[model samples]
Target: MEALLKAVVAGAALHSPLATLVQNDGTEVVLEPPANKGWVLYTVQSGDTLIGIAGRYRVDPKAIMYSSGLEGIKLKPGQQLRIPLTAGRSDREPRVPPGVEPYTVRSRDTLKGIAARFGVSELELITANPWIPSLDRLTEGAVLHIPTGQKGLLVRLSKGQTLLDLSGRFGVSLLKLAKVNGIDNPAEVAEGDLILIPGILARTTYDNLLAKREAERQARLEAERKAREEAARLAEQRRREEAARREAEAKRQARLAAQRQAQAQTQARRQAAQPATVRRSNFVSEGGYTYPVKSYVITTYFGRRGAYQRYHTGVDFAAPHGTPIYAARSGQVQVAGWSTWGYGYHVVIDHGGGVDTLYGHMSRFVVSAGEWVERGQLIGYVGSTGWSTGPHLHFEVRVGGSPRNPLAYLP
Candidate 1:
């Protein structure tokens, strides 16, 4: 019965599709009794790396890694690992064996056409290389492997590098490298090309190129760091300059505001101490008035104005400092001095038939009280004083002690 069972197992193994991959001749193996099928644990010896152990037992290093649960921990002298009894190493990733040719895709090459040209079955070529991302699209300049071929080291050519340069550097024959990579002309090799080289020197060249790439990456990282620091420094400098400019502007504004407050206070005091100017009569007159200042822009109209919404009883003209102000109509000068009612250095004229005209915020008044001034005569100069913002004239036309729109009467 035992002999019959052994013969039956051997017959089943021979019929397996993978039987062709294994040789019939091999040494016999012994293991724990067939009833006990499980992993065996073994202590890690000194200088025993995971890969070395895996190769000795024909097991995959990655499989041992999973069984041992050593995801991040380092192996040491006393670490134990689980070794599987079954053949797990047979699942090793397939590699393109030596002597397999590599083909660079041409513009009009198809997978079926290339297989026929190389006299290899499409399945054989595709099975040998699992790295092909797509079988349908054969992009130009892309490197592919053919089943029946001669082997070499694969290297991607950098800019300005030629196959002749590789032949000289690796000491291999130029014709041999070209034949392995399916290149008709050795001189036609371009930059950014993936090609194969023919000797032991090919491995050395690949290693050197890898080291150079690492060095270049380090240099780029350092340059980027410096650029970021420079940008931050410049940004900080601009922020400081802008802050300083804003501070200076604020200080200037504060000084101007303080000056206005002081002037308002002085006028309020003088106004309180003096008696109010009484109207000459209650008679209301309709008299035509002239422009107070030539070449002036009407800044403030007679109405409610400004943030405080004060009732502006007069019209304001914007002009340069010391611009002459003229009398609106012929009348007796009612008052020509600092006003008791916030009008600094002002002039009031009583045009009979009960109409009166007043000019406020003057630098100086040329006419005195009771002086007869003609219409269009220069009575004063424009000034920024007593409730004034800048160099401008404040003109008013009063009828029976009430003010009217100056624009309505001027023209």
Candidate 2:
């Protein structure tokens, strides 16, 4: 019965897809145990990493990771993991579609460098394997798909830079960069986002970025130079306009001086042409007024004059001390007193019709108040008294107490 049982077990092994042998003692020996029937369902326990759980099942970490589309070793407690039927059976490759190559990430290898080495675009690699969360998580010992058909390199975007800027720097077109990154609006790309540069070297990209910065710097300097030149031009224009204004003012003053001299000469001629034999009026008349002093030398004229601070308001006759001052017309003496405001000993005479005459800077009065005097009569003497700067007769002709130009009434 033992021999028969041994022969029966060996015959079963021939069809069992397993090896069975009978030793000399007629004991049945199985060469390899059969693989686990179907898949093994494992409940995640505390302190379990993906690698640890895969080790317990004698499977690759990714084998468990790919089942749930997991990226890293993060595994939750109480989670169920489905172990493949052929997980530990000589560790085989996963199923991949046609025209794709399998690659294992190694130490110090970057996703950009790997894509460049294999002449594959970083976007194509990511699309082939959609399990990776980001390019930053492409750690060592991770498996990836490399697309050998299309060739390009991968790179991450930097700060303060745009896709157009990179296109100029890396000698790439904007449309090409946008198409590879699947960007609809180039300005909407986020910083640190991954992109692909087709058929370019790493060293060449670095050199291009440097050259672009230098070109921008030169453009800024040129703009500043033009601004300074424009400011200088405006300043020169203002200076020319100011110079022209000053020259015009000087010419106007010259013309006024000439006109004043001509007026003075014409007045002197008319005064010298007067009839010297005409008899003086005994009573005040509307016209025919005479000079208060015999001398025609005038120290100051009526109206505004350069020597006085304000309008002179009267004429001034310079004479020696005690020179007799006569009245210009017949009138009654209204005042005879000393004044402090440059009008020494002054006298006022009212000649009816709102007309009056004032004699200032006098030495002494010969006529008293309310006394009637005729034209050319002795009224006072010229001397430096009160606020006088010199011995002169300050004569004024007034209408209603306000001074008028004495020359308008003088012969």
Candidate 3:
């Protein structure tokens, strides 16, 4: 440049408008033809790169990009690019940095082919060009800015390997690796996907890495399968244990029920013995009856008490469970145990005069059936054994065999 400046002696007339700029700062002046050289409407040919196109026209790549409004666009054959024959005086060549270059994709071109052609790793090529839309496929005519960054290693992952693993093995940040591969979700990585280990030059010393990863994946799957089998076995064991427990519980309950039935049968045998001699009562029979239980509350009064109500045969005497009950009048004990009807464990006394007093809902009868007893004698205890709601005694008086209110007879 000093020689060129010295060659033009003082007062020598410079020919082009760019001469002044070139003379001012020789380094800043792009060595291209003057703007007067004019521009040509050039048809984009096959396999044309932006850099190659700018080189052919002696113009700045940025100038072409600006003129075509294709800063991050791909180039295709049959597309027209305005090729200025000369660069502007103020224009500079290689608009991008020194480590980066512009690449225009043409028809029948592929990312791999371009990468191999340029002896660059595909990962670097894609990363340096952030405008790339997808990873699996390249745009037909995308203008790529290829960055000559640190060399990269190209490796195809086998089954069960992922980008995360690649990042770990290759010492690359997961984020950087994902961005380079155009991955939105790092976990969505697939096996057999092409991986570019940035900053690592292509080599074969790490051939065993993929095999190790595959083995690890197999081990994990086997462990998971064993865990599932163990869980199933434990569940089956629990179910069997539960079934056995329930069976034992059912057997225990059956044994208890059988014992109760046998005891009831033995009690029944004590009853229905020879009838006790009927005896007259010493106490005065006020209204021809006595209160069955000593201390109680009249719960349900006998006779129709409400409209549309049925004739309540007996007066319900509410008392605590197991409260002692007495005979209403002197009579022979008729029925003395469980009554399958509404009355629970109960007793009935045939009070001789074609009248019988029924003491229902007894817990147990101390006096057996066919045994005669005087008025106010202890016969049984209060209970809710049959259809009775609570610990209460149902007391009734009868005319012939028909039920009558015991309340009318009691004092």
Candidate 2: lDDT over CA atoms? 0.68
89-201, model 3: which lDDT tens digit per residue?
Answer: 22322223234455767667777788888877655665554334444355443566665644455454566777778888988999987766557786655443445556764
**C-alpha TM-score for every candidate:** 0.31, 0.35, 0.31
Against the true structure, candidate 2 reaches a TM-score of 0.35
lDDT of 3 at 119: 78
- Winner on lDDT between 2 and 3 is 2
Residue 81, model 3: Cα distance from true site in angstroms:
99
Give all candidates' CA lDDT scores.
0.68, 0.68, 0.67
Best by TM-score: 2
Q: Is candidate 2 or candidate 3 better by TM-score?
A: 2
Cα distance off (Å), candidate 1, residue 407: 0.9
Instruction: Judge candidate 3 at residue 402 and give its lDDT.
Output: 90
Clashing pairs in 3: 73-143, 74-141, 74-142, 74-143, 344-386
Q: lDDT tens digits, residues 1-411, model 1?
A: 454456445433322212222224553433222322245576987656676566445567787888788784356998988866463222222222355655667678887798899886555555444344454556664556765654344555666788888888777788877776767877666654556555343333334444655777788899999999999999999999999999999999898778766765564455335543222122223654677787666666787643324588998776788988888888999999897787788999999988899999899989999899888888999997787767778899899999988777775
Q: Which stretches of candidate 3 lie over 4 Å from their true place?
A: 1-284, 305-309
